[model samples]
Target chain A: MSLLSLRDQLRSGSVTPSGLLDDLAGKIVSRDPEIGAYLSHDLAAAKAEAASVDLSLPLGGIPIAIKDNMNVLGQPCTCGSKFLSENYTSPYDATVIRKLRAAGAIPFGRLNMDEFAMGSATENSALQITRNPHDLDRIPGGSSGGSAAAVASGTAFAALGSDTGGSIRQPASHCGIVGLKPSYGRVSRFGLVAFASSLDQIGPMTQTVEDAALLLGAIAGYDPQDSTSLDRPVPDYLATLNDGVKGLKIGLPKEYFGDGIDPGVRELVMAAANKLAAAGAELVEISLPHTEYAVATYYVIAPAEASSNLSRFDGIRYGHRAANPADLLDLYRRSREEGFGPEVKRRIILGTYVLSSGYHDAYYTKAQKVRTLIRRDFETAFETVDAVLSPVAPSTARKLGESAHDPLREYLSDIFTLAANLAGNCAISVPCGKVGQLPVGVQILGPHFGEAKLLQIAKAVEG
Target chain B: MSKPHIDVRYVANLARLELNEAEVAEFQGQLDAILGYVETISLLDVSGIEPTAYPSPVFDRMRDDEPHESLPLAAVLQNAPDQAQNQIRVPKVVADA
Candidate 1:
């Protein structure tokens, strides 16, 4: 059932949290072997947790899947890398997980992802690549692929996902669901395993925009533990879901519709815009002139920071370590060698090279400067329109091995979604339509802290 | 920009990966292509703009230094491949020196 529909049933006592948990367990048991959405499940603890939930809360026992990168206490937080396969158990629930639990939501399991949230496709996962439920042969976008697939496949009412450059939205789009990457500071990252720490933010993925709003409301707030979390007042995302999109000016960036975007995906997104126009919203042709620079800038900035964040995985304190090393250096090398996947290793090298002494000023420093111009491009566009509309990916989900042979093709998958992230603005991807039976996503991007408006506009289009 | 000819062994060593020669050759081509696209970032004119680091302007919201409850030793070690006295165990590391 859609999370919103499930919420109605929950409020009326037709489905208990325990019942939802049972249903989720059954779904996982039946479908997960093929989809490989989950890395770990704690049914006994989940049931015990669900049994004690206070049903008066808005979430009221809704089943939620958490991305494996976020700590859920007593569960393994592998971050989809073999290096972390056996070394860590979250000492305590992440701030978001605690909030979900308090809201009477059941945290059913931890989902798979790109190792250390590095790759754009889930194929880099050391566990298993999560397949799109819409078509098993196609990839369920990543690194939040498992979360999106689980939600899209009805394994949970809604799932929590972390976005560092379109990890949440792209996969959600590919799976024919709704995914939100909130304003950078909107959601706390207290217990999220760091992956390009500056770019990571946790958000929700669900079947409908309204469900995304409901999930957002439950997990967003100020957290003293996360230095980047905003101290600003949290809005009632659900309360504003019905705000009509009448008179809302939506900007369509010409750069996003250019040659690389598939014609079919473009048509579907344009149709979504037309539907919004029919519902009384106005559309304006806008230009984010530096849109072409986003992929370039994102690669530099994300990797530079990732290099710094991943330094903690040394064989010293926590995580996997190699056995019977000849020396300390060998231990460090072998442990890391044994632990990280090909993509993770690739990023660490690229990141390290960029941040190293001689190249730092040339690559990392220069990329940061470009990031500002990219952000300004959005600021200028938002001034002319209430929200920006575009396709979430350049095309529909490619078949499982289609882009794997070429890593650049894989990185290009986030071309459309990265700009919203680089600007630190809130954006959501909703399934606009199908292109040749494959789902396509239309994105709604707004100014910083504009999640409520974005969700409102998304809901309008959802109808 | 002309693509750099990536040395598979060098790249793998830098990345701390123990790849066989076949894996190295395969990754050499993949890394070269990815780097080729990433090189496009250098073409942008970011002349005077300040680097956009964190998404929001707010910073330094750290928690107090007071200790919170720690996980039980057993729970922490439940998934460890090797452990001793509540700490994870790893191979020695002196050889690189």
Candidate 2:
């Protein structure tokens, strides 16, 4: 059932919370082996929470799937890596998980992801590769691949996925679902295993824009636990969801629509723009001249941040450790070497190299300046346009192992989606149409904390 | 700007990750290519622009200095690879002179 319909049923007492759990449990048993979406799930614990769920609250009786990185008290937060898969368990709830529980939702499963949210595909997971539900041979885009796969396969009603360079939106596009990345600092990052502190934002993946809005509503707010979380009030996303985009101008940045986009994908996105235009929305052609620098800027900044953040997972407390180390340095080296997969190590090396002495001034400092230009580009574009629209990814989901050896190629696939994180704006992926048998999403980028207006246009495009 | 050559062994040591010869050679080649692509940004004239720490404007959130309940020691140490007497155990970092 859809999330809203399930809400209605639970409120009417027509569907018991535990009964919904039982249904999802059965679906997971049947489908999970094929998709490999779940890392682990504690049905007993969910039942315990569901047993006393308050139907009066929003998202009541709903079983929301969690990404592996978010800390939910007592659940295994493996982050799709072998390092934490052995022994680590969350000691406290993440701020988003806390908000979900307060909204009367039962957090259900630990879904698979790219190892420590590092890759463009779930293939980076040391635990398991979560396949795209639409085509089993193709990848569900990562690091939110498991959340996207679970929701796409109907094993999960809705799932929460964090976006750091298109992890959430790209996968949702591949799986024919909706994903939102709230403005940076719009949602609290407390207890989320930090991939890149500045780039990561946890948001929802679901079947519809309304459900995405509903889930975002429950989680977006100020929290003292996260130093970067915004103090602004979260306007009702659902309230403005149905508002048509009349007189609102949407910008199509020329750089994003440039060469290398698959012809079919471009056609679908243009059709979506036409749909918005037909519905009284004005389409504006704008130039974000610095768009080309986004990927390069993101690569330097995200990894530099990730190197610092991931250094916390040394062999000391609450993670995998090498047995019988001769010394402290040996223990730290072996534990991390054995725990982290290749993609993670590559980024760590790159991050460390960029921020290391001699190169720091040229690489890290230069990337940061380019990032400022990227942010200013969006700020300038939004002066005239209410939002920006483009293809969520260059194309639909690619077949598994196609570019496994070329990490740079995979990084390049994130071209359309990386700018939002670099600029710290709200963007969403709502499935617009299909390219061949694969699904494609049209991305809507709004100014920071402009989710109400973004969702308003998303609803129109979703139509 | 000239392409930068990465000292893979030195970088691995700094990152505290142990990599064999095969892994080092492979990653060295790959990292250089990635660095080559990311270096495209160096061509942009950003002389006067300030580097962005975050895309959005945010402040360091402050709270009252009040006592709060902490997680139980058992819960916090439950995932420790080695623990004893409610403390996480690790290899000795210091040596007797």
Candidate 3:
């Protein structure tokens, strides 16, 4: 059930939170063995926790699944990596978890993700790869694959997923659901396990735009703990969500529509745009000229930030420790080598290389400058249009193992979604339609802090 | 394979990760390819453009110097690989002469 509908039932006393948990438990037992969306779920703990939550609150009685990266107190925050998978338990609630609890939502289940939310697909997860529910053999796009799958498979009322580059939206697209990446600072990142510190934002991945809005509202706000969170008031996203795009200008970036997009994918995205146009949204031919550099810029910047952020996982404090190390250095080296998966190690190395002396200017600084250009492209486009629309990914979910082994191939798949993260703009992926039973989403990009208008446009195109 | 641009051994050492010989060779090739792809930024003239370190660029965020309750000591030590006397224990850093 959609979280809103479940919320309605709870409000009317038509159903109890315990009853909803049982229904979700039954669904997971039947479906998750094949989906592999959950890393762990504690029904007893969840029910116990939910018993105290006020039923009159906004998200009261809603059991939202959380991506494994966010620290929900006492829950396993594995981040799909061996480092934390073994014995690490969250010492405190992440800011998001606290806010959700305050709003009376029960955060249930640890959804699987790429190791440290680094990979484009869950294949890089050290624990287990979550498969797409649509086709069991194909990958659910990641690093929010588990969240997307759980929500889509009806196992979750809604789920929270973090978007570093295309993590949330791409996975939601592949799983045929609604995924949102709010403007950087629109949502607090204090509790999210850092992937790319500057690029990562925790957002909602749900089955509908209405649910995304509800989840975003409960979670979006400035937290004193997160210095990057904006100080401005978070407007009610639901207030204008149903407002049709009667005369809003939506841009169609020509660069996105160019070669390399699958014909089937292009047709579906265009059809969705037509729906928006029919609803009085002007589809202007916009040019994000620097769009070509988004993936490359993101790869350099994200990895650079990730390498620095992930350096905290040395053997000393709370993560994996190697046995009988010869010295302190050996302990640090061996523990990381043993704990991190290959993709993670590769990124750390790449990040170290770029940030290393003499190479920093040529790579990291250059990527940041290119990032300015990318942001400028959006700034320029938004001046003329209310929002920008494009395909969420180049294609639908690929069969597992198809691009799993090739890092470059996987990185290239994030082309369409990286610019929003780079620009720190708000964006969402609403399922447009499916291509041969596999789903794709039409991405709607909004100016920074423009989520209210963005969700409004998303609702119009949702049809 | 063509000559690699990055010294994988040096970078891995800097990252404090110990990769075996086969893993090193495999990563060397992949990193070189990734580096080559990321080199596309060179085509654009980024001169005179200020680099963006953070997306929103909010600066000087400070909180009052207020004391608050800290995490319980037991919970803090619970996840430690090795802990003794409420402290995280690690190998000795000083080498005996």
Candidate 4:
């Protein structure tokens, strides 16, 4: 059932949150073994929470899946890695989880992810890889792959997913759902497992733009725990969704459509643009010339930040620890080696190399400079247009093992989506069309804190 | 000018990862290929542009320091590999000291 339909039923008391939880549990029992979307299921606790939910609230006991990277008190947040496998249970609900519970949303389960939220595909997960619900042979995108697949497969009304690079959008694109990465500081990141500190923001993946807006409204606001959370008043996202997109200036970046984008996906994106044009929105051809540098810039900046953030996991404090250690260095080595997956290790090494004393100027500093140019490119483009339009990914979901042989090919899959994260802008991936049954996502990007406007535009396009 | 060879031992030590010989050899090939592609950024004329460290111009959204409630100690230790005295236990570290 659509999340909107579920919400309506939930609000009218036709379906109690407990009943919904039972139904979800049944679905998980039958389907999750094959899909592997869930890392841990708390059916009894979830049912109890659901039973106690006050139906008077907005969410009203909607079943919601949270990505494993986000702390849900008492849940095993493995982050799809062995490093924390049996190491830590969050001491408190993440800011988003608390808000979700406050709005009467039932916490269903913790979903799988790329280890440390560091991969573009769920294949990097040390645990079972999450499969695309639509095509089991293909992968759901990462690092929020499990959340996307769960929502796509009707496991939840909406699922919370974190986006450091293209995690949320790419997975949403692969799963054919609506995923939004709100402006970086718009959502509090107090309890999120940090990947790239500055780039990471938790957002929602849902079957509809309206649901995304509803969830975004509940989870977004200032938090004292998160030093970077924006202190602005949270806007009424649902109220803004109905605003028509007439004369809305949509910028089409020349770079997004170039070279590697698949022909079928491009056709669908252009068709979506044409449909928007037909709906009275004006399309402006724009140039974000520095777009090509986004991938390189993102790799450097994300890794540099990741290297620092991940240092806390040195077989100490919290999370995974090594067995009987002969020495401290051995403990550190074994704990990290056992905990992290290959991709996470690769990123850490790359990041450490870039930040090392001698190489900082050439790699980290240069990449930061490039990042400035990338942000400038967006700033200049935003001046001429209200929002930007692009493809969420260069192509539809590839087979599970297709890009595994070449990591660069895997990284390049995020090319179109990375710029938004790098620019710290809000972007959404809305299913534009299907390519012989595979879904293609048309990405819509808006200025910082323009999530409401972006959702409205996406809703218009959806209509 | 040639691309610098990434010292495998240095990379492994920095990441605190133990790489077997086979894995190291495999990673060397993969890293070289990946770096070759990433090296394209060096070709761009980024001369005067200030490196953009963050996308948004805003900085430091600090909150007031206040005592906040924490989850029960038992609940926090539910998934811990090893714990003692309500604190996480790790091997004695000499390097950090």
Candidate 5:
């Protein structure tokens, strides 16, 4: 059942919350083996949460899937890596999970993701490979691949996914769902395992725009725990969501529509833009000249932060210790080498080189300066245009193993989406159309704290 | 302009990760390509622009200095790979006599 229909049914007493849990449990047993969407789940716990839920709450009895990176008290937060799986279990709940529980939502399952939310496809998971629901042969884009696949496969009502560089949006595009990457600092990152502290934002992945709005409304607010979390108040995302895009000027940055974009994907995204224009939104051509620099800048910055963040897993205080090590340094080296995958190791080396003493000025500092330029490009464009529209990814979901051999090609795939993270703005992907058997995603970007306008534009494009 | 040649072994040491001969060779080639691509940033003049370490406009957030419950020792050490007497244990950094 759809999330809305389930909510309606539960409220009207036509379908009990236990009935919903039973149905979802059955669906998981049948569909999960094929899709590999969940890393861990407990049906009994879900049923218990369902039984005690207060019906008066906004999200009463709703089952929400959590990405493995977020700590949810007593659950295994493996982060799809063997290293974390070896020793770690979350000792406390993430701020978002607490919010969900307060709103009467059952935090049901831990969804699969790229190991430590690193890869462009779910194939990077050391634990298991998550296949796209639409076509099992193809990938569900990552690092939020399993979250999107779970929602697409009807096993999850809604799921949380983190976006560093299009992890949420690209996967949602691939799986034909709605995914939002709220403005940087819009959501607390307290219990989330940091990938790139500056760029990562946790957002909702759901089957519909309204569900995305509902989930976002529940989680987004000021939290003292996260230093980066915004102090500003969160507006009712559902309130202005239905407000049409009449008279709103949506910009199509010339950089995003150029060569390398699949003709089919471009055609579908352009169709979406045209539909929004037809619904009274004025389409304007805008230039974000620094768009091309986004990927290069992100590669430097994200890894630099990740190197610092991931250094915590040193086999000392917590996580995967090497047995009978000769010395402390040897223990750290061997444990991490055994724990992290190739993609992760590659980024760490690159990050370490960039941040190392002699080269710091040329790489890390220079990239940060260029990042400022990228942010300015968006700020300059948003002056005349209320929101920006672009293709979420260059193409639809590619076949599994296609990106495995070539890492740079995978990084290039995130070209369109990385700038939003660099700029610290709100962006969302909505299923606009399809290319062949694959789904296409149209991205709507708004100024910082512009989620109301962003979701409204997404709703405007959404059928 | 000449492309940068990464010393993969040196970088691996810096990252505190142990890599064998095959891994070093593989990383050297991949890092060269990635760094070559990232070299584009050097072409632009960013002398006047300030670096954005954190994307948000907000800075130096201050909170009330009130005592709050801390994570219990058991909870903090729950994920420890090695534990004894409520403390995490690690290999000795000092050489044994």
Candidate 6:
């Protein structure tokens, strides 16, 4: 059953909260070993809470798995790296975790992700490679692979994921689920381990658009903890979600639907766009001329921020410390080298060089100027269209280890969805149709803080 | 494979990461490709445009500087790899210097 139906069952006394947990637990026991969705689950604490949870709360008794980056007090917040896994107990609840608990949802388990949310595939996880639930040999789209996998496989009703450069949406596309990357400051980032401070946003991965709305409603808000968080009201996302997309002009960016896109995935996305147009929405062609520069800008900006942010893990205060360093410099170097994965090291190096004195203007500063252009492209497109539609990625889930040989190939897959992060706009990935055994997702983008209209259009596609 | 453009050893040193010979060679190749791709941004005419450090308009959001209760020292220290006398213990920098 979907989250709403499950909610109805809980309220109607058709099934008790404990009974629901048992069913979810049974699924976890049966499926999690194969899927590798969870890093750790607190069944004892979850069952204990199920007994006394306040059913009056909006998300009462709903099980929500968390991507490992967000701190949930005592729960492990391993950003899928050996450093955080070996050290760092969350000292406090992230603002979203506090909100989820208040809304009566169980923040049940820690799902695996790319190390510090860096890679597109969960293979970057120091612990395990999360498999796509649909086909075990394929990768669950990542850095939030486990979050998408958990929800896709029914171990959790929904999950929370952080998107920097399509970390949430691409995984959702690969897993064939609903993933929303809320506007850049739509949700608090206090406890989310910083990947790219400017580009990261916490969002939902769910079975349906309505569930995404419910999950977003529970967590989205302004928080003083995250200085970048906008001081804006989060609307009741469900209020207009079911209203449908009648008369809404959905723009299809020509850049996204190009010859480079896999023909099978393009057909599915265009078919879904046709479905929305048939349902009273107008489909229009829009130009985002700066689209080609988005990936380059994101690579520079995200890594620059990451290099600055990750400098905090210096082995003294928190995370893994090197054993018997010859000196402080040696400690910092050895600890970071031992702690981080190869992808992380590569990004840190790239970021450091980009921001270094001689190269800063030529790379980082230049990238930022291009970022303004990319954002302007979205602004121009939104002037003529209510929302923009496109394929979430060029292709469906590739086989495990397919992208391992070449890192650039993996980065290229993010070309379609990376611009939304650059633009700081809200976007969603909804399953449109199937491509063979894998699922293809269609992406819908709205202007900043246009999640209500975004979810509405996503629901029309879901229908 | 094409020749690398930047000194990866210098960048790795700046990043505070120790890279072996093999990792340096691998990263050099990968970084060259990535830098080559991102170099496309330099072709655009952004002469008059301002660089966007933050995507959003809001900046320097300030709260009153007031004293508030902080996390208990024990809780903060829980994750420390090495500790002594309620403080994080690290290698002797002065002695090494």
Misplaced by over 4 Å in model 1 are B1-20, B64-97
Docking quality tier of candidate 1? medium
TM-score of chain A of each: 0.98, 0.99, 0.99, 0.98, 0.99, 0.98
List model 5 lDDT by residue over A228-294, tens digit each.
Answer: 8988888988899889999999999999999999999999999999999899999999999998899
Query: Across residues A1-463, which tens digit of lDDT does each residue of candidate 3 receive?
Result: 6777888899998999988888898889998999999999999999998787788999998898999999998889999999999999998899989999989999999999999998877988899979998999999999999999998888888999999998999999999999999999988888788889889999999888988899999999988888899988888888888889988898999999999999999999999999999998888999999998998999899999989999999988888999999999999999999999999999999999899999899899999999999999999998999999999999989988887457998898899999999999999999999989999899999999999999999998885
Estimate every model's Cα lDDT from 0 to 1. Answer: 0.83, 0.92, 0.91, 0.85, 0.91, 0.91
* Candidate number achieving the greatest DockQ relative to the actual structure: 2
- Which residue window of length 10 is worst by lDDT in model 1 chain A? A350-359
Ranking by DockQ: 2, 3, 6, 5, 4, 1
Alpha carbon lDDT at B61, candidate 5: 89
lDDT at A348, model 3: 95
Error of 2 at A10 (Å): 0.7
Question: For residues A272-353, could you state the per-residue lDDT of candidate 1 as single tens digits?
Answer: 9999999889999999998887887888788778867887787676677788777667776778878887777777777776
Q: Give the per-residue lDDT digits (tens) of candidate 4, residues A354-421.
A: 88888798888888888878888888988889999999998888889887757777887889888888
Q: Of 1 and 6, which scores higher on TM-score?
A: 6
Candidate 1's TM-score: 0.94
Q: Candidate 3: where is the Cα deviation over 4 Å?
A: B1-4
Worst 10 residues of 3 chain B by lDDT: B1-10
Reference-based lDDT, residue A45, model 6: 79
Candidate 1 backbone collisions, by pair: A83-A339, A327-B92, A327-B93, A327-B94, A328-B92, A328-B93, A328-B94, A329-B93, A329-B94, A368-B51
Task: List where candidate 2 sits over 4 angstroms from the true fold.
Answer: none
What are the models' TM-scores? 0.94, 0.99, 0.98, 0.96, 0.98, 0.98
Q: Kindly provide the TM-score of model 2 when superposed on the true structure, using C-alpha atoms.
A: 0.99
